[model samples]
Target: MCQLLGLNCATPTDASFSFTGFCQRGGATDHHADGWGIAFFEGRGLRLFVDHQCAAESRMAEFLRSYPLKSRNIIAHVRKATIGDVRLENAHPFSRELWGRHWVFAHNGDLKDYQPRLHSQFQPVGTTDSERAFCWLMQELAKSHAGLPSVEELTLTLRELLPQVRRFGSINFLLSNGDALWAHCSTKLHYLVRQHPFTQATLMDQDWTVNFAELNQPGDRAAVIVTTPLTRNEQWTAFEPDELKVFVDGLPVEVA
Candidate 1:
């Protein structure tokens, strides 16, 4: 299985703090170290980086940890190599274009013998069940709407489409289109929102503590989603099995 991390913020924010702890899981603090990648959405433009190297040891990951590139939406993944080769193409979070917007997705669970009919321009470039699932979902979404639908409408379509894939196996995943981030829990996932009156928090994987209240403005807010809780002090809410939720402006919204 892989691990996923996503950030949706009220304003452009750098992921260095969260990613520093996350990349540790790729090889140092945990065992999912086949490869790792990340995506950042800057308005209509996107920056994507994928590498067939452990995030803990990769120079690219370290550079990102030191550089402060801000984005309103971001997605990252550390692979464990269950269904794919340990190559660059197999790294996530995968990116594709739909309705003139860049869509990013990353999966955390393995699907057993699951394959769907992919049509149009949606096709898998890597021999991974996760990429196949992403392509199929994109294919179906393209068919469901003539153009990009509203977040609420897209969520509805996803709710109908995901169950079809869930029947095969666990489908825990994170998806974003620079508008909102959608997260589904097939097994384990936790998320927390950091907003007004922030407090100091320490990383679980490293002896790093930061007082976010000092770094962020009063109007700043961010939602952090991960396969496991990353902070030792922050309150994290676990997602219920089969639950799908959307986050916008660093907060979860009710979407039917």
Candidate 2:
């Protein structure tokens, strides 16, 4: 299995802190050393980066450590190559245009014998089941709605679609379209929110600490969703088995 990391915030925030720990699984701390990718949402646009090298050795990953690209929504992944070759085209956090906005997706689990009938509107550029699933999802959404659907309506549609995909294998994923972030878990996932009374946080993978109280205002809030806790101090909540959650403006508003 691979590892996933995501963030949704009320204000633009850099993910260097959380990513420090998340990257460790790609090589240094764990054995998920196949490929890695990350995406940042800015307004209606998105910035994405991916590398075929292990996160610990990838120069792209090194740049990410210092690149303070702030964004309200972010999605990232480190692959262990359950399918497809360890190449850049097969990296996660794939992006495609939908509803006039960029939709980004990343998957952490493997799918077995998962081939879905898809339309030609969007096709997979890579051979990985992860990318194919993403294309299938976008294609389905496009066929389901003539125009952008309301959040409530779209959520209902997604709830129905996800189960069919999960039938193949583990289906943990993070998806975002600049407007909101959606996360689903078939096996393992966890999340946490930091709000007003922000406290200091220390990373578990590195010797670093930050006092959020000193950097954030009383109204500032940020939410982190990951496969595991990134910090040693802050409390993190684990997602229930086979659960799905949606985060809007950094807080989980819908959970199922």
Candidate 3:
């Protein structure tokens, strides 16, 4: 299994704080240490970084923790190999282009004997089931609509489509396209939102504290979703099994 982390923000924001604690799970504080990757969406452009090395020990991960790359929608993962070899290509947080927009996906669960026919333009370059599943989702989305649909419309389509794959095994995942972020839970997931009147927070894995009120503006807001709670003081809400949620501008939106 792997660990997932996502941030959907009202304004462009850096993830160094949450990432510090989350990356520790790659080898230091937890067991998902095979490989790790992250994706940052800036406007219509995307930045992706991946490594086959354990995030806790990788120099690349350490450098990233110091770089303050800001993005509105971001997805990251620390993987523990279950289906593919420990290689760079098999890392999570896979990326693809759809309707002229870059889409990023990361998964924390494994699928058993689940292979969907991908006869469309989308195809997996990696042998991991996570990439295969992402390609299939993009393929089906292409067939369902002529172009990118509204976020709500896409949510409706996903709700109908996930069951087809979930029957095979756990499918907890995070997906984003620089605008809105979506999360689906099969067994484990948690989320929390930070907004106005922010408070001090402490990391669970590291011995550091940050007073967000001193760092964030009144208008700043963010919605963070992960496989586990990243902070010790934040009120994180656990997702029920088989639940799906979408966040836009740092807040969960209702989909009717």
In model 3, where do residues sit more than 4 Å from their true spots? none
Give a tens-digit lDDT track for model 2, residues 208-256: 8999989888767888999988998888999987788888888998633
Q: What residue runs in model 2 are displaced by over 4 Å at the alpha carbon?
A: none
lDDT of 1 by residue, 214-244 (tens): 9999999999999999999999999999999
lDDT string for model 3 (165-191, tens) is 898899999999998999999999999
Q: What are the per-model C-alpha RMSD values against the true structure?
A: 0.6, 1.2, 0.6
Candidate 3 has what TM-score?
Answer: 0.99
Q: Ten consecutive residues with minimal summed lDDT in candidate 3? A: 107-116
